[model samples]
Target: MEKNEKNEEEEADEEFEEDYEIKILHGYENNYYDISKPFFIYSKENLVNFEILDSILPMNTSKNEHKSGIIECRYQLSCFLRLTRDVTEVTNNLNIQQFKYILMTLKFLKAVENKNITKLLQVLIFNNFFYQKDYKLRNYNLHLIQILNSSFFTQIDFHLKKNIMSSFLNSLMIRYDFYDENLIIFKNSKELFDYSMFSEHIPYKNLMINNFDAFCSVENILRDSNVLIIFQILLKEINIKSLILNNFFRHLNPDENFAFLISKIEIFKAFTISNYKIPASPFFLFCLIVSINNNIEYLRLENISYCRLNLRGLLEGKKLKGLILSKIGLTENASLINESRNVYETIEYIDIQGVFLNHSIWHEIFQSTNSSKIILHFNNSDIEEIFINNLKKFEIQKNSVLYLEIKFNSNTLPRGFCNSLIHFKNLKTLKLDGYIIYEDTESLLYKAIYYMKELECLVLCQNCRNTKPYIFLLQNSKIDCLDIQSTSNNNDAIMIEFFRLHKSMTRISIKDAKVSSLCLKEIFKQKNLIHLCLDIDILPPQVDQESLTFKSKNIHNLDLCNNTLKYIEGVDILSKLYRVHTLRISKCNPPPGYLSKLNKKCNSYVKILTYEYGILDFDDLNRIGKLGNLLKLNLLGCKFSGCSFFDLVTSCKFFKSLKTINLLNSNIKMKDFQCMKRFKKLKRAVFSFTEFNLLTLKNSLASLQICKLKFHTMLEDSNYNEFCLYLNESNIYILRG
Candidate 1:
């Protein structure tokens, strides 16, 4: 009895297991099943045929049992039967075989719910049984329905949304029915069409227009700090249409727009539309702008600031027009902006300030454009190859160009630049300051000056040292107005030779130059000089005792300040320079005889004498008192023993012509300066660097009627409050040391 009861329990358990497996498979299949049957059922009520299904039921099966058994067989099967009945009721009903196959597919799907079973179903769907084209046995629509109803369908939707779907469909189409399947599947579902995957399957390209939000999402993803992977993936998939690519870049943050992108496209049309703050990349923006191969006529990048960009490759392009890059800090290659193959035809005007450009870049730019107007205000020490190359190019276009201004700081002129000047054929005006150049290059500089046949005005205001020899060589070079000052080089021989060579040269200046009798002799050779600056340490040369003479009569003005001459025996010869209207001789040790002779000789012209820091006794002053034409007198740095020198100056009637008087460092007491007021024409009076008491001097000078008073005192010992008050009260431009 115990064995029989156990056997009964075992048999029941086995029956339960079989039923459970069938139910589990049915549930799995139902998950992937389409629920479109309800729509079909609601739409096809007129074509519903209950008679067609009446003959299919088994005998003795009640309506309730038939309905329950059908529904319980499999969820997919019940869905298919319902869909078939709905389709039959519709006007265009599905055929019998199609309907039956659909039902069978639904039943098969019921067993494919398990992952292992679903994989097996996928293989079966692609194999001969389901994939064959023969209508008698295999049906593609039925196969598709079965596969879609399996659990694998849900996984497909999750993993292969749109992109993967397209990729998978494309791959299958390529492998089977290459042309036909690709066209059919692509037409049905474009979202599942990947061009790369369908290359072998179809010749037609499947491209989608980039959506606005899609572009924004890509840009946002790229902008995030840790989205490099996303950016790379998007880049790979993104199409190269200009509009789409531009939109993607438009949303990038200002600081994120680095040089990496600039190096790739070269042209940024939207640069003017968006004010994206540029990244602080080391490469310069100008280099990038000039390097792009595309037409840049309308490119408007206003405030792009960068350090330097390589422009070596950009020199081959057509000229760029109206290029404006200002207030940029460019390093090493600023000159490259002007260097292009056809730069002359394109670029017109350029203004670059506070940019650290290499000289070679400038050389190329100048050579390429022959720019009519260029303004470069650079303060750099190094000289580059661009300087020489540019000069050569400038020389080539000298006839047509108008304005060129350059301000740079250097210890000497750059190498080869002096020689390159020969190319300035039509240079009208040239202004140079603080240029350090090599001595050997000076020899070649004459070639540049010789070529500049139309050079009119030249200004060498500061620091002309290494090129003095070259300047001397350029004496015959065409020039009208020449201004030379503060050149501290021992090239006196060269100066003399220059004067001798350029006798036709109108304006000549030897200010603050160490000149001797030999240099003065050289000056005598220039007969047509209109302006003469002889302000030099005129102490007689150690070897020479010969008296110097100014035989030229064309001298209009002469500055003979800072000279040492005790005797005026040479004046008889200087009296021949009758064209000299203004004569200045300061800081000289002149004897009574010399002063008397000078006064007698210069009686017809305006004479100005400055006696500073030397023994010019009352005798000398008495002699100077005889000069009736004296205009201005300065006695700075002089030692006087008594008030007799001042008395002599005050008594002279010619002193009324005095316009300025400087008594700086002269050993005269403040009370003694009271005599200066006697000169009615004294416009400015200077009492600087003197040992006189400030209060006394101010009190004495206060009574004098003068337009300007300059008092320079040692303020180190002065009271700060008093100094400030004095400065405020006195409406003067004061400079204290």
Candidate 2:
């Protein structure tokens, strides 16, 4: 027995010595340890010791107690002493591992001393502990609280201490209700004694209210009349459960009449009634109610069945900041005169959709507000008459409005409206939604374009069957951004001419428009164009190829979607666009070695290259590997099957600069992603489909420290529970699995 005791004692000593060596080694090398290294090393080595210590610690009397009483007691005591010493050393080391150790020890100690630990541990638990090296250590508060019961806490005033109070407040802001009920107990303890604690906890009611008294304390905070009234409004807006509502009402005692007035406002009723004339459904009414209760200012009245607003009484109000009246059937002489006269000075945003505003109403509006931004939707109005009558009125008040949106449904714009636009010299952003330029009005459009020289952005959607007017506008406009969607065919020459004339255009989009080789050649000559989108039916036979041979490469984002191109040569043209970063080719078939040649030519400058809605076989992956500086590669809706794509991604060690790899809606597997960890600089990864298990992917990605991670599954059989577990374990930002 004595011999056995001596052996056990020696073993304990050796264990203690090993722990001491580990603590000393960690302390000495703490400064040198790199935080960017994978966390698995620390988890395996350091956490294993903690687990072993937890096993040996005793909390209750048991059947095995007598069988190994003396040995177990000594072993437990020695292990505790070793852990305590190690924790102290780690805390002194001031590294990520030390911080993690401190948190882990606190958790273990709290668990062991449940209902017995002193108040100091509780206070320590509330304090903001910074690892300085490990960002993950910030989320350890819930775990600490979970292990310690409320009995361990003392009646110390939390608000009086300002050192780590902010940190404690932030901690209370997070949800902690898991399998354990100790968080509930702690919250209830705070509520039962201290009214001051209620103030700090009210802002985070969604986080804490698992226990009984916690709800009442939150109600008390809400009942405080001196507090910001916005809090009450926000509380009502949040979809609190019926149980919570009942608890709130039970403890709520309002001294002032404001809360009572707010309660009596019948927020839901007001919302439903206000939108009744606007043809909104009950669901929409609820949304509006929630928005209004939350004081959300930005409201869109699109497609709402609105008649003339009964604004005869609205003339009394002083501040009418945001007003949206889109798709409302207000006549030319709607009862907006009084309202416009009263709050027009205060109104900042005015949206008039499909409303017939005659000359007099326009005159009144222009005369009323000096700095309001107007969005006029004349989709089904007699725009010509309105424009002719209101042109002089608008010109006189050019300094009043900053932004204008003129949307027309017809293909041809009224000559009068085009003529009137020339009068507004101070227009900042002009969105001409539909193709509204007529052949006859081309001169007027050009004149308006010249007049609005101060215009920053011009959006002209080619909803017209004819593309000539749009071509005219693009060629003449000096606007910074030219977003044109041409619906007509056979306008490639006009577009080429337009770009040739306007070399300083910043962003241009010609979706479903034809562009000839001459047009591309002219476009290439303009190296100042940053963002270019060309959706041509056919690449200008072979002539365009020659033009591309001398391409000027200043383009940053080149989106060639749904273009007709059998082969893409003259990639040498891209060498001239030195700043080109993103290249997108969708629904097009190029020559077999076209992309490969481009990749080889561009080398490290190409950052993003995406191919969607097309066939991308193994050859494509091999070609993609040649772009050394490629950071983001999206292969959505592509026909690349099997493990070849995976192999290509894994083997591209030169793709160390790669940050985002999107393989959504592709035929890939979970196993295909096993080699992703090789990319050390990868920050974001997206995967879709049920075949890729979120839990498996999350576990695999845990070591990557990915900043933005997304997982999407189509199957109803997906394991959301396991996915959430993995998400919680890993510190990934976004989890959509």
Candidate 3:
């Protein structure tokens, strides 16, 4: 017994020494890549000085004309409305129809000095350099054209397109400081084509390639010359900081590929391999990442099949800062060691998205840890019952965890999980989804939650009706954001009580639930709520619309999506809210005079509005045209006479702030779309799936202020290529997915 205790003490000291070495290596200078940031949060603030809009509006444009034109002197006033009137005019010398192309090229030069290209776009647009182009300027123009073709020009004859793409790449390779850090390769046919065209000029820091959802055969991928060249280049040259290989890496020669990767393992910081069947022993990857030469901070292996991963050795590692294992399986009848040591002291994030593990492996992860700000996500996963029991028996405390999510996948919670959660007292955000809870466990959950003093956000999803009354028990806590879903019938009383108790709620989302008049009245009485999302069922037959006035004047964003109601009773109260500027309503019929009431009450206040899959009459169009601050109007799948709609909007004398208009799936007369030339502030126009009158569109383009156009059609294959080439020749920026 004394020898066993001494052995255990020696193991603990060795683990501590290993952890100290890893912490010194990672030294708080670099931040781990946050995979949680949503993709829609485009950091547009980085390029505000450049005139590029980086329009994310879903629009597509198609036409038949291919003639390029010169920048007209008359376009100065319309294009530079934001600049002073004394801005110099170009001498009609250069033909630059859309200035956004230059803007995009400058944006793509991520590592280039911004001061050199700071005024480059404005000078090219407002100067005479295009006509009397010097040799250097001509080369620059060729480079931009090549980039445009490779990025957006997706016509056929890819082999021939590579010839034109080489000049720009040859120039780009000379600029050693300007290397692409983030490259997405082989995710789709378009991305594949782009890589094929630019494979010879490969320079990347962090590469992400996906073959799981792509419609590409592994045999064809292995035979592709471009893929081979890129792999060879990556092995020899690129010091890849982060690498993601999805599904296709398993088919290659493992010996050669693994050898080259291990040769360059010292430079790798993050690595992910997901959704494939591995060979017998998976320790090749595990050993490579955790080897002494490599300090890989993040490791993710998801949905791996046919493998017996050595969990004991992986858990003993001390360098990994983020570890994610999702739906991993072991080979049948596989045997491993039933031993565990101290948990990883350097791990700050552990996301287990569904894995089958025994008590020992669980103990290796939850046995002990020294991290102070760990973020753990147990999404759609199961934990060992013995592990939970051991946690309670040993009296282990996990107060270092800051953000915790326990989202089960159609599974019952282990016996003592909820009772054990009171140990996470420092938790700030907690999400519980898709669990089958009994009344006793529910009470225990509330009791555990009441101890979380630092908790600010709580999300409860699935089986919420059973969990409703206990939710109000959180009112004593200081949670400012609440999200609840799957509340069944007659939840109005519960919601009313919740709102009354938690009047300080700032952001609320109640989806897949039902609420009545009394509940809505209580909701609007909250003076602090800023963002509200309600995807509820039909309102009751007897709603008092007169009583539903604007009590919450601070609400800025209101989303009522997927409602089955024909006419939402008190939706017109949106017009009376002083600060409610953004409204999104989809798949719902409005009440009698919805827009007319808005027009009369507060037409000039609303800035962004979207009404999709509904009908808009003539009066609705007229009223929409008069919204003074309206910047974006998306009328998707809404039927109306496009001719009359455009005429009313262009004829409006009171409103000119509209910058984007999306009329997708609407009946449009492109001949009357020419009337859009009268709206000088328009930056993007999308009329996809509507009529494409080529002649009228060309006639309108000369006078329009749009920098981006989204249009396409169900044309013959030959005509589509010609349409793409024509747009490229005409200098109109085309967006690719």
Best by TM-score: 3
Q: RMSD of model 1, in Å? A: 38.4
Query: Against the true structure, candidate 1 has what lDDT?
Result: 0.44
Model 2 whole-model lDDT (C-alpha atoms): 0.48
Candidate 3 matches the true fold with a TM-score of 0.51
Better of 1 and 3 by TM-score: 3
Whole-model lDDT, model 3: 0.53
lDDT values of the candidates? 0.44, 0.48, 0.53
**How much is 676 displaced in model 2, in angstroms?**
12
State the lDDT of candidate 1 residue by residue for 455-566, as single tens digits. Answer: 6666555555444443533544566456665654456666666666566767766566556566666665566776766565544444243555555666667655555343
Error of 3 at 516 (Å): 4.8
Model 1: what TM-score? 0.40
**Model with the higher lDDT, candidate 2 or 3:** 3
- Clashing residue pairs in candidate 3, if any? 59-710, 60-710, 60-711, 61-710, 61-711
**Poorly placed runs, candidate 1 (over 4 Å):** 1-396, 400-408, 415-420, 428-433, 454-502, 510-522, 534-548, 561-582, 586-596, 599-614, 619-633, 641-645, 652-660, 676-685, 688-727, 730-737
